[model samples]
Target: MTVIDAVRGDLAEVRAEVDATLDRFLAGKAGTAPDPCLPPLVEVLRGFVAGGKRLRPLFCHCGFLAAGGSPDDRAVVWTGAALEMFHTFALVHDDIMDRSAMRRGRPTVHRLLAEHFAGSREDDGVAAERFGMNLAILVGDMCFAWTDELLDRVEVDPPRWREVRALLHTMRTELIAGQYLDLGGDPRSTADPVRSAWRMTRLKTARYTVDLPLRIGAALAGGDAALMRACGAYGRPVGEAFQLRDDLLGVFGDPGVTGKPDLDDLRAGKPTVLMALARQQATPEQREVISALHGDPDLDEERAERLRDVVVATGAAERVERLITIRAERALSALRSSSMAPAAKASLSDLVAHATRRAR
Candidate 1:
């Protein structure tokens, strides 16, 4: 089997076991638990974690293997679990912050919780939204709490935990900062969409999605500075490619498969690399249409399809695709030269390919 095939096998086992552990953790909690009611938190976490691709955990495990740590080791499993919990927490908070409606073909935590609240005797919209957001925020906090608790179970030295902690904190901060930057929509940078898109992609998605997971995994496996640096070099480009692929999907992917509204990115005025390129290359009249329709919530299918035509006719999608291909190639080159184990390199290569080529 290929490295990914093997990793998926191991990943299946880890996911089930980790889920059971989370369930147990929730069940064992006292009614008088120090924090808010544990049941809601547990339910939200379990729901959020369901049906995920488990990409972050795979990265963590791959890093361990790359650093010469055995998959059979208990520490590797715990490391992966900790990182997965961290991801769960991040997603809960992210959905709340973004006011997103769905994830992985299901209602997001906030929406789910809000619907549940609305069903109660008090069915006010404002109240439901507030309750849902508050509950989700706390649920996210609870997940974060569990992540740290899982990490503490690792028998690694305090110094090692410190290093991992710093990396985690840095990743979280960067993701939040990226979200803010994206929301602010600074006009000066919008003048040059390619550079702006690259910047946003790197900060908003790449760093947290790819780099931190590998770096933390390597650190936990006692990888040295040079090896860690190599992993970072490998991850960032692959992460960018991953987001670029996501951009492609956002514009062109089937809603049934992608589980998102079509052209939602355009509606959000996301300033993606593809959109920027289209803007840069469009005729004056085409530019006017794009500018007027970019973020219009009332944009209909006819308009959206026309905009898609413009994006393709202008060659922006092709250019972004080229960029994705180039970055994927560079990422592979870096992975090959890194001081990681052969199996680890193979796994990373598979991950890079999967990230770049995913249809949804």
Candidate 2:
């Protein structure tokens, strides 16, 4: 089997463990006469978990294996599961903050809750919408709580925990900082595409998505500082490439495969590398079109496609694709230089290639 297949196998195992732990936790609460909304909240959690590919857990497992860990050791799986739980926590909050309506093709937690409230109300829909959002906020909090609980239950050594803690803290803090930067937009914002994109990509995507998980897994396996550093070096570039691919998908991907509308990022004015580049190079007419339509929630698919055409015609797509290629190469080079076993090196290389080249 290929490395991706192996990674998927490991991710499935970790996901199952997380599922059982969450079920048991919910059951305990149920037995104690939990809130009426708690059952629905758990149902939302299940939906959220089901929607993901568990990429974080897969990275964690791969890092553990690269650090000389055995597949049979259950701690590796538990550690991987902890990363997935943390990722779920982040996504739940992100969707709320983004005011997103969908995730992985299903209604977002807040949106779903709002819909439920709307159906039950006799009066106008506004009050119901507000109530549903409130409940979703609470349910998302519960998911975050469960993430912490999962981490607390892991049986890794104290030193390993410390290492994982450091990475987790960095990942969480950096992502929030990136989110703040993203939300706090400026007409006068620093307009350097490379600088802005790097800042956003590193904190918002790279460190959290790839580096931290790899470090956590490797550290848990008692990998040396050199090896851990190598993982970070390797992961950063791969993560950036992965996000670049995601940015492309956000604009140009197939809705059926991506589980999100194409060009949704353009409508959201996500400040992605593509957008930054487009802004840098667009003609006055092109800029006008972008400014008029970007982040406009009312923008229909036809208008969104027009904006996408502008981005492509302006060569932003080409620029971003070049960067993706560069990052992918760097990731491969990092793996080659690392001291990991040959099989592990092959696995990581395959992962980097797959992530960078995927259509969605």
Question: Which segments of candidate 2 are over 4 A away from where they belong?
Answer: 1-33, 185-188, 191-194
How many residue pairs clash (N, CA or C atoms closer than 3 angstroms) in each of the candidate models, in the order given? 0, 0
lDDT of 1 by residue, 78-182 (tens): 766777777888788877766778777788888888887678746689889989899889888877887878877777777777888898888778877777666
lDDT tens per residue, model 2, 182-250: 674544346575568767888888888888888878887888889888988999999998888888888
Per-prediction CA RMSD (Å): 2.8, 2.8
The numbered model that scores best in lDDT is 1
List residue ranges in candidate 1 displaced over 4 A: 1-8, 11-36, 185-188
TM-score of each: 0.90, 0.90
Local distance difference test, per candidate?
0.78, 0.75
Task: State the displacement of the C-alpha of residue 171, model 1, in Å, after optimal TM-score superposition.
Answer: 0.7
